[model samples]
Target: MVDNRYTITVGTEQFRFTRDQLESDPGNYFATYFFGEFTEASQGARELVIEKDIQLFRLIQAHLRGYDIFPLPDAAVPPYMTKEVAIKNLRHDAQFYCLGKLEGTIKDLEQTSVKKEVKNGGKSPLARRYKAGECVISSYLQTWTFQEINNDGYQLMLDKLKNIDIAIPSRRPQVPGFSVTFCWVKENYYYALLVSDD
Candidate 1:
């Protein structure tokens, strides 16, 4: 079943709607239109402040794009009080696994990390290699593998890289901080990794 129950807040007013209600009369346009206007108006703001605040816009867009927002079962009110805030939180949540991959590499599967098992496992040698700072290129002929991971979030990024028709090369940036850039397969977004040495 499609888990609905999304929290939408307009100004100070917040409402939770199930999938049936969202799909029934309101159609999601109300939420989308409001956020669209909000972002459009903010485009002219100073870049520094805008950069910090654009997350609000992203949160709304993610919902309109049909991403599911699951509230943590134990939370009080839901981490997000507004639609924009929810999207930002979802994006952050989606990133957790991807960030875990990078963090796993950074910690080197030391004695005290949760992902030490995945790191040491022989199954994903490529991930292990990439974690160890080795550069590698891989390609996949089938698109199904890519589609299968649509909901896996950014960790699916690696699978998408694998599915590219042309060679997708990945490299660890020489500098410490977490930025690795590879060739462009789609557009301006480069296949990259953010790694930190601990």
Candidate 2:
């Protein structure tokens, strides 16, 4: 028997599916067609990304259609936090987000310093943990210019300081919009470029 347990949230609506439902005709067709199109697409260097997104989309759809794709709770889940609330919480909780020009400068420099310590066997345990290549997420608020400066300087500084593993190197799009760019400073402290077209 195919296990098709999964959860899906569309806007404010949440739905769950069992394995049997996921394996049902409609669910399978949706999964197959969507993934088939994704796989057949001419992806140059972005094949992996395309595949990953397709898989995620399929899983979500499967869950929505009552497939047991994942072992989820039967209880009603809480509503998702609003985007503004989520962003606000992230800023409050993240260790690396800076508020002003001086804060941005100091944060980046401090992270760079930590990177140096990890390389030379310094005292920060967090730095050592980071040098080993772990996934981290942080949020911050800063002026657009500071964000740009951080983005420009990020890769060069990482190469100079750590000589350690870096995952998913920073990418800057040609499009105009607001987005955050993440980079390793030293070990624990990170430099984030918060851009806005406003």
Candidate 3:
């Protein structure tokens, strides 16, 4: 007989979460994946295999368990990864899971993280602009500008728009409303622009 349990495997890790625990949040992806009509046949099976990052999934699980995903203790994060990267990955996982609340928390953490980076002297030029409530956008061929939450968001966007170069002033601009532009020299031309508020 099939046991009354739900199992999820991400990478080399496996996690067990109850139906209620997964469904506690309305519109949660896990809830529907395990209980929705598509899952009727597997309701008895109650097992899911996700080809995603295990460490990131663990953080998502921690959030489900009511642990703060930000400012993660040194011991909680893997030795090779930085908390900033973890927070960034967590945002993606949260989005994939359709965990609205988790996404909200991630945004709050992003803002806080940017502030902390500035204080700790680990911030990029674009970071300060983001902290100032200014919007930044990246683009290729000068057609459309892609806007993200900043800091980690900027990095993620850049990764997606690979073969690009980022250029920001090393010294803080003394003037207000200064903008930074990131361009790249690839086989095909590409560019990303970040405009700050006045």
Candidate 4:
């Protein structure tokens, strides 16, 4: 009987996976390459060779083998890379491999990370980009619009706010510290009008 084990050569590193494992996720890069019309046998190939980052590939393999791929424990992250870098790298490889599950997991990690960062007083992308003297408008905005986010207040905002985006606004230099010009609650939701004097 022919061996069903498949050898995957990624760069100079070599890893082995069973045929069933490689074909588990149909339509993914591996399944498409191995079982699609361009079968390895057609080219007399002994093993699958992928010219990609081996570190990312290793993480992908771990994920495929039922490992929780996101929010990796401290022990799992190498000394050379931070947890954030690992997540980003995995996100990149997951997209390239067309792994939907991994992609979804990464998104969840991102949201969780954002929440954690905010809870720990880390500045958000919105906070970093927003400037004094500029108006931020949202039709579906909330009362938390320009309210100062005390540690306790952030929990309330994070729980109630599903999404936020900046609509049309006047020009202002990007600066920290702003105030809410107007705020109101509408149908269990909140809206805000923010303006500041720089």
Please give, for residues 1-198, the per-residue lDDT of candidate 1 as tens digits.
854455554444444555443343232343333333457324531111212233343433334444532332223223224332343344454344233322332344333343654566533322322221322334532121111111123333444455567644442235444344333333422234332322
Q: Candidate 1: worst 10 consecutive residues by lDDT?
A: 142-151
Pairs in steric clash, model 3: none
As a whole number from 0 to 100, the lDDT of residue 79 in candidate 3 is: 46
RMSD of 3: 9.6
* Candidate 3 global TM-score: 0.54
lDDT for each candidate structure: 0.35, 0.36, 0.62, 0.59
Cα TM-score of candidate 4: 0.54
Candidate ordering by lDDT (highest first): 3, 4, 2, 1
Off by over 4 Å in 3: 1-3, 40-43, 115-125, 128-198
RMSD of each: 16.7, 20.6, 9.6, 14.0
Clashes of 2: 18
When summed lDDT is taken over every stretch of 10 residues in candidate 3, the lowest stretch is 131-140
Between prediction 1 and prediction 2, the one with superior TM-score is: 1
